[model samples]
Target: MAKALGIGGVFFRARDTAALAAWYEQHLGVPGFWLQEAGLTIFAPFPADTDYFPANRQWMINFRVDDLATLITQLQAADIPVETRPDEWDTPETGRFARITDPEGNPIELWEPPAA
Candidate 1:
């Protein structure tokens, strides 16, 4: 039997590809063709018209982060945008979360899982 262990890459269309790539690198510290931490890979395909995220956008990209507070502050200082609704999403078991949009209007969810 064949089985897949993890996501290899995430390739998507962008309006200004180079600027978008730079946005991820400058604000999110994620270079394109990334090999993320701890072999942590996510594979989930959102529906074409999914409202699980904001309705204005067609797709969302979720990334896992280590320290939410520090990252949020750094992004703010750098003039990178961040949107947080902790009361709407946070729970005792799920830890903290925030949201942001890339330069191309693709949403990126920042998730920090609860510590053991």
Candidate 2:
């Protein structure tokens, strides 16, 4: 038997595909088929009725980062709104987290795992 190795890509439909793709490339430094650094990738399915993110959206994209604080600053500098509940979102085991949205209203979660 064989199992899935890892996610190779995340494809989605956008109203303005080119502009959306450029936003990701300019702000997140990732274009289609990004070469990410070695790190953990979360595979989770939230409850259909869960309010963890926006109810209107069915899926959310999460990315792992090295420094949440620095990244938050960078994102803020770019005029992107960032939201966080430090007490609720951070933990010794997991790490820090922040939320932001793309031009198309897709939710994105940035997580920085605890230092090893």
Candidate 3:
């Protein structure tokens, strides 16, 4: 059977399109329409009241990062807010993960998967 394998790109409505795009480019180094290395991309929509993600949030974008701690520090140095849970947030099986919110109040999950 034919099926979608991974996400091509994410498109969303923004109040100030140019400014918002610039924010992503400036802070996150996310090149618009940028090509990336090979990996699986998950495209999912949770229930409106789902606790799988933040309730008041519209959506969350998770990016696979190379170094979580360094990236966190870099973002903090830039005065960006980042969330971390030391005790129960991380697991032995999977690698470390951290959370950050974009200027538009969108949740971003920075995940560093366990090394192969």
Candidate 4:
């Protein structure tokens, strides 16, 4: 049987779609039609009561990054708050993880998988 290849796109509602799209491109470098590099894409479903992310939000988007520290610095310089729990989130097996919210309050996960 044929199976789904990969995620084609992510759609969500925003108060100002244009501004939000621009913010993503400006800050995270994600454009409307992004060409992502091939890598591991995690598809896990969390319990309804899980507190991993904001309860109000139904889903969270995770993006793989080349360098987490540099990206975090760039985001911080732009006055965007980034949350990192290195002790709790980072590991040799998994990798480093950081969390940030969009201007419209959407959770975005920045993951730098362990180097091969």
Using TM-score, give the best candidate's number: 4
Kindly list the per-residue Cα lDDT of model 1 for residues 51-83, writing each as its tens digit. 778787766777888999999999889877888
Which regions of candidate 3 are displaced past 4 Å? none
Candidate order, lDDT descending: 4, 2, 3, 1
User: Worst lDDT window (10 residues) for model 3?
Assistant: 34-43
Q: Model 2, range 1-88, lDDT digits (tens) per residue?
A: 9999889789898999999999998887787777789888889998999999999999999988888899899999999999999999
Task: Report lDDT (CA) for all predictions.
Answer: 0.81, 0.92, 0.82, 0.97
Candidate 2: C-alpha lDDT: 0.92
Model 4, 59-111: lDDT tens digits are: 99999999999999999999999999999999999999999999999999999
User: Which residue runs of candidate 2 sit more than 4 Å off their true CA positions?
Assistant: none
RMSD (Å) of each candidate, 1 decimal = 2.1, 0.9, 1.8, 0.6
TM-score for each candidate, following the candidate numbering: 0.84, 0.95, 0.86, 0.98
Q: How much RMSD separates candidate 3 from the native structure?
A: 1.8
What does the lDDT come to for candidate 4? 0.97
TM-score of 1: 0.84
Clashes (candidate 3): 0
